[model samples]
Target: MCSVTLRPALPADLDALSALEQRCFDSDRLSRRSFKKWIKRQHDGLIVAETPERELAGYALVLLQPGTRLARLYSIAVDPSRRGQKLGEQLMDAAEDYAHEERRLYLRLEVRKDNAGAIALYEKRGYRLFGLTPDYYEDHEDALRYQKRLHYQPADAARLHLPWVQQSTPFTCGPACLLMALAALKKQTPNTTEELLLWREATTIFMTAGHGGCHPMGLAIAAKQRGLSAAVWSNQKGALFVDSVRDPDKKAVICALHEHFVKTCRQESIAVHYQDFTATDLDRAISNGKIVLVLISTWRLDGRKAPHWVAISGSDEECFYIHDPDPGEDQAPLDCQHVPITREKFEQMRKYGQAKLRTAVVLGA
Candidate 1:
C-alpha cells in the first residue's frame, strides 16, 4: 500500500495542481491561472495529497462563503494511477475537516450525472442529493447537486423550513424573497411571471445605477395585495435610499416613489413602524409564525457594496438562517438556502448604504 500526506496547497504546488487537473479531467479542467489564484486566496481552501516521493496524488478545493455558514467542494481529483489507494476519500475527509474547522454548517457540490463512481463516493461520504442542473458541464452533461451537513441541530424542528426561490434577475431579490416567504406561509408555488409582477409592483424604478430595487413599503403593500398580512419596520421614517443617489432627478424620483408607497401603506392600513427591527424582534416574529424579508448590504457576502434582499427562514441560538435569492453562478441553490449567519454578523449586514438604512417586512397569515 502507498502512503500519502495531505496538506494545504502552496504557491509551489501550482504546477503540480495544474498538471493533476489536466491528467484527471479531459474537459472542464482548471487552468494554471485558476490554480494560482485559488492557492493565494485567503478564504478558500485547497488541499493536496502528496506522495512520499513528493509527487501529487490528489487535490480538493473548497470555496467559502464569507458571510454565511456554507462551503462548497468546488473541485476534487485523484491521480489516475493513485485511484485504488483511496486518495479521493482521504481528500474528501480533509476538505470536510477544513470546512468544519472554519465553522461552516454545510458543504455542497455538483457531480456530473453520469459519473457513477463519483456519485457513489459522495453518497458513501453522506452527501445527499438535493437538486439537478441540466447541461451543467461543458460537454452538455447534467449535474447532480449534493450537500452534507457539517453541524446538525437537534432544534431544527423549531425552525421554519421555508421554500427556496432564486431571483430570476439581479434586481428582483426583494421580490424573490417575498415569493419564498409567501410560498412557505400560504403553501403557494412561485413562478417567474409572478416574480416579475411582484417586482413591477414593488420596484422603486431607479436605484444607484440600474433598474430600481423593491422598497420595504412597496413589498409590504404587494404582500397585502396577495392576501397576506404585512408590516414594515424601517429606521428611516421618510424616503429610503435617497441619500445614496447623487443625481438630483433620480433622488427626486426615489422620494416620489417613497411618498407614494407610504401613502399606499396608510390607505391599505399596513402597520408601519419607524424603527429598526432588532434580532430579538426577528426571533419573536419567527416564533409567532411570521416570515421576514430583510434588506442587507452585499458587502459582507460578495464584497459588493449594494443593497440585497433575503428571507429569514429560521434561527437557532447563535445564528439566523437566511434564504438568499441571488446564488451566484459558482454556488448551488442549496448553498443559498437556510444559510446560517451569526447574530453579530447579521447585525452588521442588515443595514445598507452610508446612511446605514435598516428595513424589514414582516408577513403573516
Candidate 2:
C-alpha cells in the first residue's frame, strides 16, 4: 500500500524469502536451498519487494528456459500482510522487464487451476492461459499454464502456406493435423464434420481409458484413401500405446489395431521411413511445396503426456512454425493455433512413448 522498493534478491535474504514463501503458499513452497541457489544464478534469479520499513514484502523468481527464447515465472509469493496491495502485480512487471532484458521472447507461468484470484490477476496483467496440466501439483490438483508475449515481430522465415486451425475433438489431434496437410496440399478446406470423420477413420481403436488418438500410420492410410500421396516416417514398427494401457482387453485391442495398421500400410505400398526426421527434412519438404504432420509430446507446453499431431507449416534457421488444432481454452488465437517454436524445442517435443519414438507423415498432392 505504501512506497515499496523492488530490487534483485541477494544471498542474505534466503531465510527471509523462505519464511515469506511458507506464509504465502500452503504447498509447493520453495526451500531455503532453492532460495540460495536462485539468488546467485544470473539467468535464473529472484527479485524482491521491500516495504517502507525495509522488510521483505514479496519476491518473484524468473527462470530462463534452456534451449528456448522463453522465461518462466517459476514461483512468486508475497507476505500475508502485503495482500490486496498489488505487490504481486508489481513483482510480475519487474520480472517481465528483467526477462525482456535477457532477450527472451515469451514469459510464462503455471498457477493452480482453482486459484481464481491469481488467475484474474495474471489475466489483468496480459497473461493468457494457454493450456492446462492435469494433476500437476503434490495435492493432485491441475495447473493452468499462462503466457505473455514480451515482444511481437513478424518472423523472418518464409512461412509455409497453411490452412484453417481447429481442434475438433479431444482425440482428434492426429486427424486434425493430417487434414490441414491434405487441405493445404489439395488447396481445399475440410469442414468440422469431415474433420471428425477423418478422426474416426484414423483413430488407434484404443487409448489410455478415454477416446483413442490417431496413429501416424492410420493417418497415412487415411491420406492415401483420400487420393493423396503419403508416407510414414517413424521408428515404431509394432504395437504402439500397448504398454500405456493396463487392462488386458485394451492392450490386446491396441496391439491388434497396430498390427492392422501395419498390414494395411504394407499392402498399399506406403513409403515408411523407419528413422527420425530432422528439421532439415521438414524445411526441405515444405520448401518443395509439400505438407508434413509430425508427432509431438506436449511436455513443454503443459507438463502432460499429450501425444499430439501438428502440421509442419514453415521453418527458418531459428524456429519451426506449426499449425496446431487444439491450442486449448483461454488462449489467444495466435497463442493457441499458430505456434512458432525453436527447432531444438520442436526436437525435444516430437518424441513420445517409453522409447521416445520419433514419428511423422509426409504428404503431397
Candidate 3:
C-alpha cells in the first residue's frame, strides 16, 4: 500500500508513462501518437500512480467495450525499480476504480504466459483467467485472457441518513422510483457534514458497479432544498435505444420529470449533467467525486414496473450508501425541509424499478 495518488493520465504525463511502459513490457510499448489518441477518446480511461514528489511510478489504461458489459485493461505497468511495493496493485486498483466508475461489470486483460509475476498479482486480486490466446503477444507467445468481476453488497456499502426516502408519496410512480427520487434528493443537499458523508458513501457504492443516474437528480434536489449547489453524471446504455413509451411511458415520464427538475435547477442556477445513458459518462462524473446515483433495473418481474432507483449517497472502505426511495406513507421523518418524503418505506420502493430501468445521475459542484 504505497501512499500514491491514482489520477487520470494527461498528455503531459506521456513521457513518464511511456518510459514506465518501455521498462515494464517487452513487445508493446505505446508510442507518443498512441498515447495522444488514447487521451482523446472519451471511452478510454488512463490512470497514473504518482509519488508525493509528483513523479510517475506506474500507469494503467482501460477501454470500455460497448454493449459487452466489460472493460479492457489495455495496459498496466509499474517501474521495475519500485516493484513489490504494491504499485501494481495500486495501478490495478485505479483501473478497477475507473471500471467501477464507468459501471463496467468486469475488467478483461491479456497477459503474457511468461509473466508469472503479473499473473500472480492479478490472481491475488481475484482476477480469473478465463481463456488463452495463442500467439497473442509478440514472438508468437501465448497470452492469458483474464477478467475480474466487481460486486457490492448493500450491507458492505455506506450508510445514508435520508429519512425522507422512507416517506410515502401520492405520486403514481412505483416504490423504486420513489426511493430513487429520495436518494437523489439527499445527494443534492450534501452540504451538512453528515449529508456529505452520506453522499460520498452513496456514490462510492455505485462506482463499484460502474453505474450512474437520476438518483443524482434527487440528490441535487435535496441539496437545493438545503441551499447547496451540485451536479451528477451517469453513463449511457450502448446501442440500447430506450423508448420511455414502449415501457408504458414510465421512462418518458421520468425524463420529463428530470427535465423539469433541470429547468428548476436552471432557474435556481444549479449545475447538472445527465451523461447520455452510458456508464462511461457516469464513470467520469463519479471519479471526479461528483455525486453519481445509479439505478439498476431488471425485467424479471416482467417490465411492468418502474426501474429501481438508488442514491449513491456516500462511500467507504468496503461499501457505498444506497439511499432507497420511500413511496409508502408514514416513514422515518427527518428535519431536512428540502426532502419531500419520509424514511420508512424508502427501501421498499427500490424494488419497483428492479424490473426495467437502471438510471444514473451525477450532481455537479
Question: Could you say which candidate leads in lDDT?
Answer: 1
TM-score of every candidate: 0.81, 0.61, 0.42
Task: For residues 1-365, write the lDDT of model 2, one tens digit per residue.
Answer: 54688889877787888889889888878888777766777424588898878799998988765334667788888888878988888988899999999877778888999999999999998887766768888999998988877775435443646774677677888877877876777765777887888888788777776789888888999899988898988876767777677889888877888888888999999988887887778888888888889888888877777788888767766667677787575333344433557777888899887879888889989
lDDT of 1 by residue, 99-171 (tens): 9999987788999999999999999988888668788899999999888878774354226468889999989
Residue 117 in model 3: lDDT: 88
Instruction: Please identify which of the two predictions, 1 or 3, would achieve the higher lDDT against the true structure.
Output: 1
Steric overlap count per candidate = 0, 0, 74
Q: Per-model C-alpha lDDT, please?
A: 0.88, 0.79, 0.52
Q: In candidate 2, which residue ranges exceed 4 Å CA deviation?
A: 1-99, 102-156
Q: How close is candidate 1 to the true structure, as a TM-score?
A: 0.81
- Model 1 misplaced regions, further than 4 Å: 10-37, 40-44, 80-84, 101-103, 110-154, 157-160, 186-191, 247-249, 328-334
Model 3 alpha-carbon miss at residue 157, Å: 24
lDDT (Cα) of model 2: 0.79
